[model samples]
Target: MDQAVIPFDWARMLLGEEPPTFLLEILLRTIVIYIYTFGLIRWIGGRSISQLSMVEFLLVIALGSAVGDSLFYPDVPLLHAMLVITVIVLINKGLDYLILWSDKAQTAINGIPNWIVRSGRLNPDQTSDRGIGKAEVLALLRIEGISNLGEVEHAFLEANGDLSVFRAREPIAGMPIVPPHEICPLPHVEPSLREGEPSPKLCCFDCGMLQSRAETACLHCKGEVWTEAKMPDSRLA
Candidate 1:
């Protein structure tokens, strides 16, 4: 028979065969599947999609695909999809148990965190082992608002590929230690003015130059960037 202009086989389209119904059956299937999926996720724990670990992410993707296919495809048996979900959930649970109980298993599965930076210097061994370069490290530090490596006391590469940075409590004092070539005094302030003296000291940020008077331009390098050379008690790392 020639296909209808829109091929509207109401029975076959809605019910698959002539057995299940259109509005009622489809509605029931959607509700049941939704409830089941919700319960499964709840049992797995109340972690948001963003907070899901690598293993959990894969499980969510698999469950979503299986559930969606069974919900709308008449030829796909719901029971088969449910069975697959059950097996996947069981395996996930089993792996979680192993990871929790065995330290070696946990390391093997999730990997160990690498100390990318330590004590204001890049850990060359760790970076080389992980195939990370100086440029990549600098880029990540820049993203965290750290322009100078000396500002960071420590940095770690987490197992899930996130970078955690620990900043120095005090800015490292010396010229060329950090980038941009600005220098903090050896003792952080002039010794004569160190004891209870609020001196109006101005210094160039880009070039290491001690200025006697505040001017619109630096005398030595003519750089405009300048800051009062008062040492702070604490600096954010």
Candidate 2:
């Protein structure tokens, strides 16, 4: 017959079915993984943790699983986890070298920086290709205290997922993104202006390209929807 269960078997609960010497093995296992992890991290370049590229991100995920599993699971041997970690780190290092030596390799693995905004207009092709929306770009611009797209000359979505923005020396009329579209929706322009009147500056709702109100559609995006282009508020500028 099976042994009766004991409710308050503290020794069995704490120590488990293994011998007390297994505690020593656990300690050794932890030390080895800790040292190996530390050494591998040190060997890797001192890039900011916030800026982890694709390969670095993969290294973190693999090491985290292997190290955590070996640390507590009695069945998992330290050497096995260590070997996995070593192989992953070696592959990561090799990829790093390849990235350094070959532009094509770097582009393939890390991705190329995409021009999200150029000449105060959103690059719809690049932004859509990168799976970035106008709202996201606007949020990043807001972080940089940009009130409107007119204030930006250029903005790039970096390979490491950072936004790089350059301010325009002479700002032009552009679509206002601040206060968000939800709070203050873009003001639509009337279809027709008075005869012989100068055309009002209008921007494509989709791509933010400035154009004359006389045009039926935006030249950049061929979008029919448009709103009055806003000049940057001097106070915000």
Candidate 3:
């Protein structure tokens, strides 16, 4: 017999070798569900493998139940039903690969994670931009068993939809003493702003660091503000 098509009797027997179309359609449906489920979840923002907020967690359960309901309906024809599931799965996989292979597709499907914390401090604009709160921040920290603010060195709300925590052995230095280079200013602001705004309180110039404010002449290179601007950018180790 040609393998591309099944004989009517063969189809009937398979639909229910014992009862309904033999389990072949169910098996095909299962395979489609598995491949698409795994791949689609990957593209939908990494919720499958990571800790999720209450809303995110609920979405997974609802999606799984909806798919399961469609798979189990008895009135649907066996082969046709399986093909429908297969089509849906293929669409999912295709989208997943598109997101993986193209940067633009990724940006379109899921926006980036904003920085909730920078320089060991809360970033209000960034947090508000993403609609995240300090309560969520506390929860993320508690998962890492860090209850105190001082213990956390740096934390990031990562792009793959995860809260990445960085705890250092030494607590970050206090602003009163460390040079300005040691500080990381918040996003959306430039360095070298005067004090009307809440810029970093400590001035590197005051600490004998090469800056224009504390001294008219930079102590290290005797360079003025323009010369200081040309200095190499600082690197964090």
Candidate 4:
């Protein structure tokens, strides 16, 4: 095994230096802190650092504070710091391994995403588990001008440190929403036209077949709903 020998510096202070050993000590401490921080970050995870949960969030803050120690203490030897960092990194890796190997352990540490909204209802159990209440959810919804859960087609607490939602319908407008199920397309039907002038007047969406002389039906097929009006072809309107 290779070993690093860091000797104590005690004479620089006596050579008219402003406690030169203090500077070395600070450097040493910085090295140690850097190692630990790097390892912990790597092991616990740094790729998705911004997505840490509650406890992990706290650790990240603490990690920042630990890194700040370098600003005040510099005498810490770099090798010792590296050693500590390596150990921390190892520990992080060990924890991750445990999480990966055990399903139950993974759930205990980092929970899986849960369905907070289902069947147009906010699940109370799921809300509580995420440490969030209905009020918060509603508040978020309100921010998006959503008044009722019915407006939501799908809502879930994402493990990526966010709450995402999708709504069912087109929202009475050109809305991009999360659809629960694929739309069952209506069978293709030809458009109806007014009977006259060689060909019938093409169905225009702007003014549906509903003219002053309108009956309650598609003029040609007599189908009550002018389905074609709502179809993509309606863009010609």
Candidate 5:
């Protein structure tokens, strides 16, 4: 039989239908979960909360539901929630230990850093494999105050999804990314130059590898498209 629903039931709203003794249990449950979670976080070391790994992300989702539901829901048994949290933390800790000891486990779980640029030339294979496009790389370079691809000697896509760039001590003439591609689109065709004439500073459109005027395809990226290489502006350096 269903009891009649009442409007503005103060006792039901304020205290819920759980026994008064459950309130004490709720306090103990909260304390235990909080302490246990905090201790586990400390054990996991001081990695920034902002940079949560895949395993840590799972921990956050599982713990958030378990802790929140166990706090207020009368039907959610405190012991069950505690056990769930324990198992989750244990799994996380175990993965951490495994990652520390095994290079294969660490690479599998967190991935390895990818070299996206080397010697002012883009690594097309690595970028394509990592699903990083040329536009994205250009944006990252611009964020680092790069005006041209030649300014970068080496650039790596870190496992944590951060781009690390190393600048060349003596910058070379490379493909310019300034003024943005949206504002000024790159040229696709090679410039016509007389035979025996020195190649007019042309670079491969795809990988920024310097190209000879006579070459139909880029030796590095095999891209036939060419754009005039821009010397690094002293003011922008």
Candidate 6:
């Protein structure tokens, strides 16, 4: 080993002894592969890593492994790797075609979008099916700048696993349109007997009349029952 070190093979050092191809050949091959992979990815709907779907992720892994091995390994044939990549892209395109033409195929490949919130109410049933909890929903809401379910008109668990939130165009004054499960009961206030007390404490549900008490009937409209006026929270304001 010492004797061999004394006489350095400059040519071998500069250009690999058992080179897969010439230096020029390797350079061209690498360039070709890079360009081809980029075009393929673009054709197959390229997305940022954070936005990648399962199929896109798998495609990235497969392309990276194959291209990297062929670029440096003397034993790996470039043409063979290229062929494999080409076949993979072809299969991906085929799947895309199927997805476009067949509803079942699209649902199977991409999954259906789940409605997490509808009409300002959380969809408990939808979340349960997808293994999502209320905490996760709340976190997602915050990500979309929503402080509470009351502000959301509709929210969806997209097919790619992202939360898409839609806000109400015209929010109700005090009543949040949220689901029945999330409605909070208010404290009942007794009707004031004194004439000097606060006037018309609640509004009749059936009629527009305001009354100081939760009367059996509205005085003006002769309607039954009333609901307390709800004010918007500080966060909403």
lDDT of each prediction vs. the true structure? Answer: 0.56, 0.75, 0.46, 0.46, 0.74, 0.57
TM-score order, best first, reads: 2, 5, 6, 1, 3, 4
In model 1, residue pairs whose N, Cα or C atoms come closer than 3 Å (at least 3 residues apart or on different chains), thus clashing, are: 167-237
In model 6, the runs with Cα more than 4 Å from the true position are: 1-50, 170-232, 235-237
Model 1 clash tally, residue pairs: 1
Model 1 whole-model lDDT (C-alpha atoms): 0.56
Give candidates' CA RMSD values in order: 14.0, 8.6, 13.9, 16.3, 8.3, 13.0
Instruction: Put the candidates in lDDT order, highest first.
Output: 2, 5, 6, 1, 3, 4
> Could you give me the TM-score of model 6 versus the true structure?
0.51
Stretches of model 3 off by over 4 angstroms after superposition: 1-67, 70-72, 168-170, 173-237
Greater TM-score among 1 and 3 belongs to 1
TM-score of each: 0.49, 0.75, 0.45, 0.43, 0.71, 0.51
Model 2: lDDT to the true structure: 0.75
Error of 1 at 20 (Å): 21
User: Best-fitting candidate, measured by TM-score?
Assistant: 2
* Preferred candidate (TM-score higher): 2 or 3: 2
Pairs with backbone N, CA or C atoms under 3 Å apart (clashes), candidate 6? 120-178, 121-178, 121-179
lDDT of 4 at 39: 51
Misplaced by over 4 Å in model 1 are 1-51, 124-135, 173-237
The predicted structure with the larger lDDT, 1 or 6, is 6
